[model samples]
Target: MIGNGCWFEFDEVRGKIIIDGPMTTDLSFAAEEMQKYVRRAHGMFLPIQRGVLSESTQNAIVVRIMAERLATVEEDGFAITYRNGNVFIEGNGIRSVLYGTYRFLELYAGMRWLTPDHEVIYEPTDRKVWIEERHDRPDFRRRGIILEGVQSASYAIGVIDWMSKNGCDLLMMTIEFWDEHQAALRPEMQARQLRLGLGGHSLDRFLSPGDYFEVHPEWFAWYEGGRVAAQPCFSNQEGIAFLIGRIVDYCRQEPDMDTLSLFPNDNKYFCQCPSCSTQSFVSNYTTFLETVRDQLEADGQSVRIQMLAYNAQIEWTMLESMPEAASLDVMVACWGRDYRQTIGSPAGDRDERFRRIVADWGQACSQRYHSSLSVYEYYADYWMMTSLFPPLARTICKDIEEYRSMGVQEMICLLLPYEKSVRIMQEEIMGLPRENNLADREFNSETPVMWLNLYMFARKLWNSSLDEAGLIDEYCRAAFGQHGDTGKTLLYALEQQLAQLTVYNTRWFKLRYTDVWIRDHRSKGKAVVTGVSPWAKEEDEPEIPAERSEVSRRIVEELEDVWHKAAHQGAHSDESTLLYQALTQYFRYVIQKLRSIDKQSSAQSKLIRQETEEAMSDLTEALQIETEIRGWDALHFAHRLRDPNVL
Candidate 1:
């Protein structure tokens, strides 16, 4: 390898790095052609010798580039050998520059790009497998967002940034408010801020509807609890038509609003007044759909309306009865399916509600009309992991797989509580192979080790056959920096924590639907009926006794101890400051309760309270110590590190 280096010479001519490797152009034209691919990969060229194929030369090049590399690739037709002082782009000719550019970007800071070399392994199976590549894309040209009052424009933009980073084709937003000044909550959403169309929901002022309701009492619907609710009654032809016309006008006026979604996916209750009661809810829904459709089509503009499958309209037959297919897009809203599993026997028929619904909708969409249908999956409940993630994923994957099999091309997840779960869904479960049935496997919850587990699952989404150990090695190096004793410790500890979290034996109940009521009943400090209260009973009435199980209490106490310890230890680590604060507040509240219970109970309660108080004090002190670690100059140092452009 060393002796072959002198056989070639390099020259920079006409903005190109040229190399004369040992092989003549006539003998290895393919190798020369391969250089084009290399240039495409690395974005630049670092020539390599045709004869010098030594491992050490390659390894040396690798180390040098790895020092401050942006991106990299390991394969033929695309090779950039970056050395201590220089870069070598290898290939037969100048056309390979594109490959070199790709390689340049594949490095960390420059542009950590995904490339063909990312495929670590490919086991050629003996069984015949039809390898038809299908690149699935989004149907809604603009994926829209509904920003309730709480989320600001900056927050919406941040979400958009994340969405764009992943694979959102387009971004749309709407402002929803509840009061007069509250409408100004979305003032940041100006024409300059939102590149896509913006929508406004003016229901904020329509809250008790004194004159509006009086003048148009026919527009209101009587809900289950004897409360009068409002629905734009299509039966009130003039008002309904005016509403539909305004919606169409809004769509036409808005820059990129090709789709108009009207129904509140989960919030809408049934309209039970006689005029609307006798009319098929589906028929009323169809009228609204048709009105919007006819107006848009007549204007030679395209728009689609989404109806929710919530409240009293869980029926798929609603879509079947609507004849004008060209008018609107039907979105079957799937929510609270996980909670449904707990209501009935988990064993009885496997809770096929979601799966069956998807199947039926897929059939209708295919066999019925020109307008398409998509799934609006809501992970609204924050405790999806503890309560729903496992089962929901299992059901969802099976259902989506079936839907895909049945030619349902588009699906969108309407997510809430967008924190780590987004990453979890993107990198783990959704990323895994369909055949792997990864949802079936309960993920290991060992903290740092679980990071490796997460990557393993994420790999499935991109490529099916990824090397688990190799990924762990890479991830460990990235997360902890070049694996050593510390890296091992961190990985091990993370794995343990993740495994601990996954066990679901903690004191916290999976809070979903009536589970919240169940928890409230159990924890109130005495025995009560277990499920939802009867219709006759007052909503706030404590029909159930407060009966916290001794076992559950112990579990909670242990978790509290862990949190307290974490808060204390956080003082020593820079990254743990936020966690420390959050945990400190949580532990203090819990610890206070631990003491309060002692006053009402026997000697055992006193002992538990004393121990818990000690833990809390320790944690509080630890937090104080963390505060001491910060200095006035902290902001200056942080500012320096914060701006990547400066550093």
Candidate 2:
């Protein structure tokens, strides 16, 4: 450690904090964070005070803003230099100032905020520390995360603070207009522009039946027999005018909004009246969109507007030429691509089809109207993390690169909150290992990599060009602390192993119905096995796949090794230990189930029953352990495991 680089004199005791001038909310937040961590580490709470330091001030830590570095550090860039028992944090903007403080906390004060509710500040017993100079800013203009699963107020604040500190500059959370939590979060989201967008699935706000449909039946869509109040008929000139009027009114109320997303409802059916039927759904949508844009421009308003090319809008056949307007960016709503493959790879063929469609629209938008494109991606699956382990982060990283290559910079993600519940079904119990009685235990567990995936998502969005291994290293180091490298290695291996499961439908994947699997990977061999069947009697069950069983056993063994090695790395708590144990046990259950299937022919009825009981037992124990570690409101929506049920 460099002695002169220390910000405060080390006496294994308290320190004084001195401020250089007036404080803004961001700066005040920085001071408070500094105060919280320093005391946490040294048992010495520093009091933040105003004005110049007096001679009586001892071991004083100064928080000062230096304007000289503004030109060098552009936008929200920041720099930190420490010398003569004082730390100086300088920034070009409020975000930079707060970021510098967080960098200081992480590098010098041993602070780590990995997840919303999980924070680690390893206070050194010796209380002797020194941090070298540092500076950084994000690469993307709109580095943000979709706050889909952040359930509570405290959790929301944690996500905001974590993002800001990590150099993220944007957030997409559709908080209700009158939500109480908005007051707490809005202030922190100042430097990072918070965007609220209405989804395409619902247009009640823009074309509400409560106000219009009761009087004008022509305003809504024509259903099987008659008109429905849900979706609007765009052909009616008066209805279109009314819709535009409502939007204008909305803009008047939300004058400070950065962007207004004018999305159609999620349903596939659009207007099919004689006037609307002449053009495709997109033509009708865009005609109104351009009119809205023109109206907004006519009114001299400067709001960036976007809408989704969603549902049937994605199908080239269902729509004509892309929306004719150049001023609006299309937020392409898409899913069903294979996550196991990268965009240019063979596994990505299904993925490439969507890419072509998106690229075509992007080019058209850019060339015709100079408007770029963005995405509303399903980064992960919700609730299914309980069984499936998809390569969520890897796929997200791949998509971001692909999107950037197409000259698309802005990406909005959809989040589905994870719910905790123990599944119960007598027939489903057969899905467990033979001789296992694990289902007797009451517990629910989710994906172990959920937090890691979220962390990588934020970090990569900030710097997509960062080396993959290096990024994983940084995340693991912060998340698992001393055991960080071990965690990183495990995560890297996990991604590879998990990808293998995406295209195969194991009996295990059948526990839940999923259409996520890409292709069948099972070898072309069929032989009867007794213990594993669709509850069939011993005569006709296909032999369990030996290769798959070997793979499962190998994964479990490797995880056990990681679990043990990670013990020495020192986790923030026993949470990591539980995670490892639970993961290891889950694969073991898979292996055990396959074994019983392999031995099905010779096993007695009682023995088969015992085997089924055993697999359930392993599953039960793992979930019981995992329940203690994972949280309820996860924003990494739809982190689904590979499902082989669908073609």
User: Which is the leading candidate under lDDT?
Assistant: 2
TM-score for each of the candidates: 0.48, 0.69
Tens digits of per-residue lDDT, candidate 1, 87-191, equal: 454432222223333333223112221111121111222211222211122222233333332234444555443332222322334433212222342232221
User: What is residue 458's positional error in candidate 1, in angstroms?
Assistant: 11
Q: What are the Cα lDDT values of the candidates?
A: 0.36, 0.55
Worst 10 residues of 2 by lDDT: 632-641
